[model samples]
Target: MLHYIENSKTQVGKELVLMDIGAEYHGYTADVTRTVPASGKFSPEQRVIYDLVYRAQEAGIAACKANNDFWAPHKAAAEVINKGLTALGIIKNETDKHPYFPHGTSHYLGLDVHDRGTYGPLKAGTVITVEPGIYIPEGSPCDRKWWGIAVRIEDDILITANGPENLSAKAPRKAEEIEKLMIEESAFNQLELPKLD
Candidate 1:
């Protein structure tokens, strides 16, 4: 997976891209991406909806326990995103923005991002990413109030005999959660600065 930020020289526009590529030794592939604001902060409205995406991701991970179907996480994440978005008045119904988040939540992770394996069910020792996202582009069918705002929360996971383990725990998914962590780290750095005699 790759995350990138780009600044425009001619325009007041910035771009962020997250790309995930999966290949399989037996012939399979899984690819996905999620773009977001790079300034470490989202607009007020964006935050409300973005939090929903984060929650969906967490729910997906939690559903990846042993004895679950390989597609369970995706279904769980999608339901969370749909219900959350609907409650926030962003989407009218669960299947509203089907075009944007049409892809599955988790895929096999090995040689390819969507590694080759049996898709029927999930067994212990499977790795994947549970990502839930919502994209609102200009002139979309939905309300224009949220145009141009895209939010996604993705995390790598490993299915275990007991449950699932998150691999990308280092990435921040919450608005206040991220802000607090960043602020604490910044303060720590200042305190560690060399003292001037």
Candidate 2:
């Protein structure tokens, strides 16, 4: 979903807002995503889902090291997601297919969001993204209270011999940190953009 969706009616007191965005610097591109509560605060259910995704992303990032295969991070992320979803009764067990999280956790991010890197062993100096998500739209098999909740915490990670370095560290990812930053007044709050047709 690399397209913009217009929803000017969106405002405070909303549920979740996912900003799956990217930027181009000179020629190289960077992909980053930050999911936040629309009301500058998270409801109990939203917080639960958000935290699960955050933990899964962390696990995925931790697995992104030199000598590890590209699938290493995905495997690690899926394990966390399966356990979390199982605890919530969203699934039977960790060995389940894990329908909630159905995407790759890491991918090469450079000239394009999915860079042209060899699908082999990870090496130092490679930059990748760790994005784990849980999408339970309406009509999902989970409890009704868990419906309409989707969250993903993404970060540009630099693979190194030492460990993974989060390039987008300054951007808040935790539920509380995002709330704090959202509460802080922004310059854009004063300026208004013209309505689109």
Per-residue lDDT over 134-173 for candidate 2, one digit per residue giving the tens place of the 0 to 100 score = 9887888878999888888889999999999999998988
- Please give the lDDT score at residue 12 for candidate 1: 23
Q: Where in model 2 is the C-alpha error above 4 Å?
A: 1-13, 190-197
Clashing pairs in 2: none
Q: What does candidate 2 score on TM?
A: 0.91
How many clashes in each candidate? 4, 0
* TM-scores, all models, native as reference: 0.73, 0.91
Measured by TM-score, the strongest candidate is: 2
**Could you tell me how far off, in angstroms, the CA of residue 72 lies in candidate 2 after the best superposition?**
0.9
Q: Taking the tens digit of each residue's C-alpha lDDT, what string does model 1 give over 131-174?
A: 77776667867677677677666777888897888766765556
Candidate 1 achieves a global lDDT of: 0.68
Q: List the residue pairs that clash in candidate 1.
A: 22-112, 22-113, 23-112, 23-113
